[model samples]
Target: MYIRDKKTSFALVADKAELDYFHQVSVKDCASATVYSAYCKMTNDCPAWLQAAFWLRDKMSALANVENIKGFHNKKPDSPPKAGEKLDFFDVVEISEYELILMSSDRHLSVLIAINMQSNEGTSKNLTITASVKNKNFFGHLYMVPVRPAHSFIVNNMLKKVSFK
Candidate 1:
């Protein structure tokens, strides 16, 4: 974790292997030290919204510390390296036709995810889909699919709460 040209023209240094490990991070790879140093050097502490913008920018910069990997978004490590909220993939409960969202960590992270969702205005993040159950089998199983001609699974990012996290 090297910070080039820090305050007073002081450059910071870190171990190469440590840097390499952090480079290949999942949500779990971020440790307390990483989160602290990653976010501590901020120059702004403005109103909520503006502060959020800066925090996200810092996150992007911190990504350079993480390793690049394909399908990294799709994978969840068994143990979390850092302590923060993360949105887990939606789990489709086969029979219920409803899903359980795997939101872990604190509410702030959930709010962040939901905020990110609404910012896109119904793009990328498809939080919920509208569908009907059909072809119910004798074994009490029903299929939930978009059979209606005009149907949309809209993501109401604003309504989503991160309290579960």
Candidate 2:
């Protein structure tokens, strides 16, 4: 598959090859994708502290009228999804047999979580969760200064959570 310019972002950890690699492999033997690809891995299942941080963020961002980054539509789900079904929780863009594309956007940036899969055999498979962020303005570029470094660290740890089943 080909990467579109619209999918490009200033993500610190995720790259085009990474996202494409996941998309290429994610369809086989996989029914659905994970949430917060990297963030939840860092915080250990979306802890209370993270929730508090988000609360603060929402309030603060509203003050500046800047939009907060919205990640996965759902943190946990009782079941998998069906194509064309709007996610009950997350700000989803689209869902298909092979991939789950979650999205969020604002004046500063647009983020997409492309949850992909690949299979090695009838029983073996892998999940490639990639986050892509694109800067929308000068402030976005400036804001990424610190965010990029943090993202690199968080994403590295997140990879450890991957399991080949």
The C-alpha TM-scores of every prediction are 0.16, 0.56
**The candidate that achieves the highest TM-score relative to the unseen native structure:** 2
The reply for model 1, stretches above 4 Å from the true place, is 1-58, 61-97, 111-165
lDDT of 1 by residue, 1-165 (tens): 123223222211222222211111112112122211212111112235433543553455344342211111323443332323432322212111112212212211110110111112332222222221222232112111211221121122211221111
Over 2-56, each residue of candidate 2 has an lDDT whose tens digit, in order, gives 2443453222223454431121212223332443332233234544544554566
CA lDDT of each prediction against the hidden true structure: 0.22, 0.48
Scored against the true structure, residue 51 in model 2 reaches a CA lDDT of: 52
Task: Enumerate clash totals for all models, in the order shown.
Answer: 4, 9
